[model samples]
Target chain A: MNRPKKIKPWWGILPVAIFLAFWEAAARLNLMPGHLFLPPFSVVMQESYHLIASGVLIENFLSSLARVVIGFCSGAIAGLIIGGLMGWKEVLNKAFSPMISLLYPIPALGWLPLLMLWIGINEALPIAIIFICCFFPICYNTAAGIKSVDRNLIQAARTLGAADFRIMITIVLPLALPAVFTGLRLEAGMAWKVVIAAEMVAIPTGIGALLMRAESLIRVDIILVCLMVLSFMCFFFERFFLYLEDKLTGQWNQHAGY
Target chain B: MPAIELRNIRNYACHGVNLEVFSGELMVLLGPNGAGKTTLLNIIAGLAGYDGSVLFDGAPVDGVSPQKRRVGYLFQDLALFPHFAVASNIAYSLKANRWSGEKIEARVGELLDLMRINHLVSRYPHQLSGGERQRVALARALSLSPAILLLDEPLSSLDLHTSKYLRIELKQLQQRLDITTLHVTHDLGEAEEMADRIAIIHEGRIEQVGRPQEVFFYPANEKVAAFIGAPNILQCDKTRALGHGLVEVTCGGLPIVVPYDGDSIRKIALFPRDIYVSLHKPPGPKVNRFKGVISRIKDLSESIRLVVHAGNNQLLAEMPRHTFESMGLVAGQEIFLILKLAKIKVCEGGLCEQGDSK
Candidate 1:
């Protein structure tokens, strides 16, 4: 006599629902000031609704997403090119490392003033900052990935009459793809962070600008809503990138040999 | 033109060694570890860079890359591509060779059927067992229909039972494919079972090359004899020379007749299987018999190996286990031994000289 397993929806939603309920109750009971430290959850939701109605929040959200897409794409492309070049040729990697290090830790914000003067404080500045910040880790990891492809795979490919280019395309690239995807995921997250910082510095029509606007009006609820929106967007991209990574690396997981 | 030939083939590991392998012949290279068997195989495959000339059908292949050499190499590790499925892996070389799409598909299918792994076409390397993967690797190497095939310890990774089965499959496949193959293995049984000609390599050179039985019976030197399972190697200083191809050497204070050339060394060698044991202590006529003390007895299923000390020479003799058991063979018991003069081979210089067994 096999019994059906009981399902528990409460356990599934317990942590988030419990925390939100406690927050709403505490704010409504006037345990803390509702304007700043303890803004009512309902008030934050109302501000979110008002912002969406005015279309400002949607524009800013779309603009932020656009920047992330452009910046992440550019970063990934540059990383793949430079990383592959460096990984294949030891001389190139050695020559490029010092230059990469010089610019890596400059933070997207630190470059805002200079980029605004050179490329202007327009959308280019923010996208460029994101590109610069995300490029290093992606390229470095990609080079490492290429270098780490099994030597036996290369030898086997060569002995099987595969020429240099074919071996690289068929054997090297596929084996390096998993490591390359890891770099892309890491760079995607970095793109989100750096793009937000870029928007905060130079862009006036983005989620970061929304944060700035909330601060100016001293609307704590709107500020909290904007921060939460940023987090949600990051979460979405993370999950999307993870799905891509899984698709690429799932083959390696199933095939344990070499 | 020979199917393959290496003339004055001097490399870092093998110096001044020449070899010629015939088409449709299965040549086995036997050597202990560090004897450069794999190095020689790799050189023949053009996988390792060498200064010597390797010719296929009279044309020198020294300048050609291994890929262009039309030589298939099954590495000892059997490096299979993990990302590709079984069929894709086997078809990789065909695709690389620019074969037509239909031809590639047909060839891969035929090879899969030949290797008896058609059902595993879509499965990856990890999904297959060791023996299955080995067959897949072999199929992949053979995909392009190479001119020659080189196998390095093909069955070493397998267990005894699987190795036995694979050895049979490998021999059958080589004949069916009609490709000249150089199979390297340290197992003497594998050589005896598969080789048309056995080349026993020692210290990076071929010591003897002949039929398996010939190499075993007539080793070029004492080292070669011992390595090929020869049990009794004795140092016999020449005592007297009787004309007509015979020399009398006194061993164990007993005179024995040995057939030797005028420049014969004072040493003689005998394999354990060549020596016979007898129960009667009375001397036998027309057969060279010696009194020996059975020092140790070992039961080897169908046969028993006895360690007997005769004439200051410790001789190991393999006899029927039933005969030994019926005789109630025990240590410290005196026994009579008949040395087969036809089986005793004398080295030129001395008994214990070292030489390559090719």
Candidate 2:
């Protein structure tokens, strides 16, 4: 049952509201010439409405969302398969762990220049960038999850007449789910950042592309609108992933006990 | 014929194990920690590799896969599948053996009723209490009606009352099912309570195997005597052979006779229950009589344990609380003792390390 009396989050919202109000006031009063750089809240809202009405904002948002979603999914699938194998089999681990560790530290966006050169500013560029960013965490977490399955459970399953493959499917995979989810969440965040970076570098239609174009045109309001839209998208996805994690882990924890 | 047999099963630094358990008997593999009892069970379950052969009903199963080995293992932790509900966990082994859906359902239903866990069919392991989890695990292991049941300290983790109750339940169930069961535990009390035959394992070797009363009274070696709960072991420095499986020995300057084939036994063990304590002397001073002062008294709830000091030797004597109260026993009081010479266990000749005392 849900608790009836809840602590209002108005206190948490106060600081952000105050900051935005201060910005709006400064822009409206034109405190200084540089006030142009900080547009009023009304101006930002008008710019957002115009973009939405013209369909630019929705199209660009959809474009960025698609890239991130597709890239993240492909990368996560690959990571789970590869990492599960690496953790399950010693030979695969010995072969791939070193390479993963070596490559993990390098930011996925760092490959943008080389990728752009090879793939030439197409949709592939951002997708590849996002995929690169998502892969490492997903792989690492999944491997750690698989490795974390208790040895006793496996032995028990074997004695219960489960073959090696059945043991892996029934015991190993389920036990590793928590860790796999952890990897997916981390990769999703990284994927969003990579998509933005790649789009800013060279995308025909995306929020990141709009932000760059607005930067060139010196349209501070449109830039701020684009920034806010991107942030809202990221926040929404983060909450969605968190809810998914909570539901799955909550079910798992009930089964696993303490 | 034996239900399960381990012949020269040596692996993982365990000593050579040659043991057998007959059909329809609850065999308790008793030992202290690091005794390789679990390893022996693992070897029989085909979970651990061993050099020698394991036979079930006189058939060699050395090459059988663990999946094909019809031995149900109940681990110390139970190892129930946490993600599955009680019914599914029980049905898991059956499904693995390729049982059809309807058969699995029927089998799970049967096990649920048998284990009295039908009410918990849909409950996850975490949702159940310790005893419930234990029963569910047993149901899962028994789903396949295994050739032999291997219980690896299944009752060790429960509370005292639960362990005691479960011990009786396990015994009755084993009898009803007539399943050859090999239960491993370091708890001597449990072994005494449940084992139809007690296999005394030590350092990976089965030192002795016999009925509960036999192993308790007539341990074949010093290791078995020490491991069993013999509170009084006397040093026999000089021994002379007597006729026909008897030995006369001088223990702590007192001569006593013991039943044995040789004169090489350097020590003899006496249970506290075998010794009688009295305020006045009424018998002859022979192999069974001694004079000692009560050094310490331990209240054991149901019974009292009294340690007697006799000529640089500490002898333990146990009696009912009613007897202790009736005799007005107290520490530092001098008393006469009788050890019942016929009950003296002439331990097999070897250096036997004493297991944990009490």
What TM-score would every model get versus the actual structure?
0.76, 0.79
Q: Evaluate all candidate structures by whole-model CA lDDT and list the values in order.
A: 0.81, 0.84
Worst 10 residues of 2 chain A by lDDT: A249-258
TM-score of 1: 0.76
How far residue A39's Cα lies from its native spot in candidate 1, in Å, is: 2.0
**Model 2: residue A94 alpha-carbon error in angstroms:** 1.7
Over the stretch B238-354, how does candidate 2's per-residue lDDT look in tens digits?
A: 888878787788888777778878648677877787788989985664666778999999986667889989876888888879999999998999998887766677655432235
The candidate that achieves the highest DockQ relative to the unseen native structure: 2
Tens digit per residue, CA lDDT, model 1, B1-358: 7799987666778876678888988999997878888888777767676766888888998878867887888989898998898988998888888999999989998998999998899998888999999999999988888879889899999988999999998999999999999999987768878999998888877888888767765677766765676546566665677778887787656577788766545667676877888878655475468889999987756578899988777888987676777888889988898888876767554333442222
Alpha carbon deviation, residue B294, candidate 2 (Å): 8.0
Q: Write the per-residue lDDT of candidate 1 for residues A1-258, one digit (tens) a residue.
A: 999989887887889888899899988888875455668788889989998999988999999889889988997899899999898888998999889878776765677788889998787777888788778888888899899987767777877999988988888877888778777776777677777676765688898887887788887888898888878877777677778766766775543212
